[model samples]
Target: MTDRELDEILTTRWPAVMRRVIGDDSDDWMQGFVKSIARHSKRPSWRPSAKQAQLMQRLVADLSAPPEPAMELVER
Candidate 1:
């Protein structure tokens, strides 16, 4: 993948991370994770861990595949 694509991947995964670790998650854990990685990173880019990446990859594949129709389209 190109640098831009890599950045997009990281950008896109940000929401997935928050969804996984939503409310009741420890604040410090989130803050420190961001702060530590943020310090060295080029942007507020978020990269999922290996396991997370696998889950995200599967989620993406499942989403990418077209859904079966609830009912067939008919010609007018």
Candidate 2:
């Protein structure tokens, strides 16, 4: 995809997914992932490689999946 499109995804779409995945907590891994993607997108020569695009798509899918159900203990 074009740099502009990537930038839009990174700026607009990704943050929403991040919020869903991590809530308000400071997740270092997520922060670093965003920073890395942003850095690449900002580079003059950068456009998302096919693998990068695929990875982003997978991440969105994974993050958007419903949260696992919590289990409760029962007292006898």
TM-score of each: 0.36, 0.54
* Tens-digit lDDT track of model 2 for 1-76: 6667667678778877666545656478766665577667666677677987887777777776887899998999
Which regions in candidate 2 have their CA more than 4 angstroms from the true location?
A: 1-8, 17-31, 73-76
Per-residue C-alpha lDDT of model 1 across residues 1-76, encoded as one tens digit per residue: 3456446545675445444434436477654553443344455555556664565455445545676779987999
Q: Candidate 2 at 23: error in angstroms?
A: 7.3
